[model samples]
Target: MRRALNIKNKLSFIDGNISKPTDSFDPLFTPWEYCNDMIIDWIQHSIGFEHRLTIAHADIATNVWTDLRERFSIQNAPRIFQLTKAISSLVQNADSVSVYYNTLKSYWDELEIYEPMPLCTCGSVKTLTDYNHRTKVMQFLMRLLRLYSGSGSSI
Candidate 1:
């Protein structure tokens, strides 16, 4: 949603960069109101029917965006656990190398979404990312080794 709003040049509406004019006498009030209403409508249409009522009474785009974010951005532990289990149990088996790698990559991508790396300015983020990639590569190779051993082949 942020990307979509950014693409449309309306991210400022929800990001609070463009404050609404309070006075009706202000010349900016009319244009601000129009843009706010449009942004509110865009948000309303993007959400589910069950969630529409929660933001229906919100007049400000920023308020609506905040409400939705607060409601849905909680960490999902169960999903993270499921993805972790799947990644640990996955094996190359009879699948082609590309197929096995793609499946593992998808699992890793979703798991990262749930447990994203922390932002840092100490220049450790790159080191952490490199370490994570190395770990994933080791896991993939270990699983492939099992497949080769079971097939009477030496790696």
Candidate 2:
């Protein structure tokens, strides 16, 4: 949504970079209102039917955007737990190397979305990312069949 708004050059409507003009006499008031209504329509069209009412009374694009973000950006504990359990219990079993790897990668990708690494400017983020990569590699190796374990064979 952010990317689409940016592409349309309307991100300012919801990003707080531009504010609605207060004076009716101001020349920018008309154009700003028009753009705001357009953005509101785009947001409403993009969201689900069940969520439309939550922002139906919103008069500003920023308010609508904020309400939607607050409503949907919460961390879901049950989903995170499910993903973790699945990753831990997964094994190569009878699947080919590529199939097993792809399945594991998919799980990992979803888990990352739920539990994303923190960002900072202290340079610790790089170290943490490296550690995470090494950990994932180990987990993948640990789940492989006995024949492939420590065999040094190309995947």
Best-matching candidate per TM-score: 2
RMSD of 1: 4.2
Q: Put down candidate 1 lDDT per residue, 27-126, tens digits, no spaces.
A: 9999999999999999999999999988888899999998888866678898889988998999988898889989999999988877899999999899
The C-alpha local distance difference test score for the whole of candidate 1 amounts to 0.88
- Per-model TM-score versus the true fold: 0.69, 0.70
Segments of candidate 1 deviating more than 4 angstroms:
89-107, 138-155
Candidates in order: C-alpha RMSD to true structure:
4.2, 3.7
- For candidate 2, which ten residues in a row score worst on lDDT? 146-155
> What lDDT is reached at residue 69 by model 1?
86
Per-residue C-alpha lDDT of model 2 across residues 65-128, encoded as one tens digit per residue:
9888877668879988998899889999999999999999999998887789998999999999
Clashing pairs in 1: none
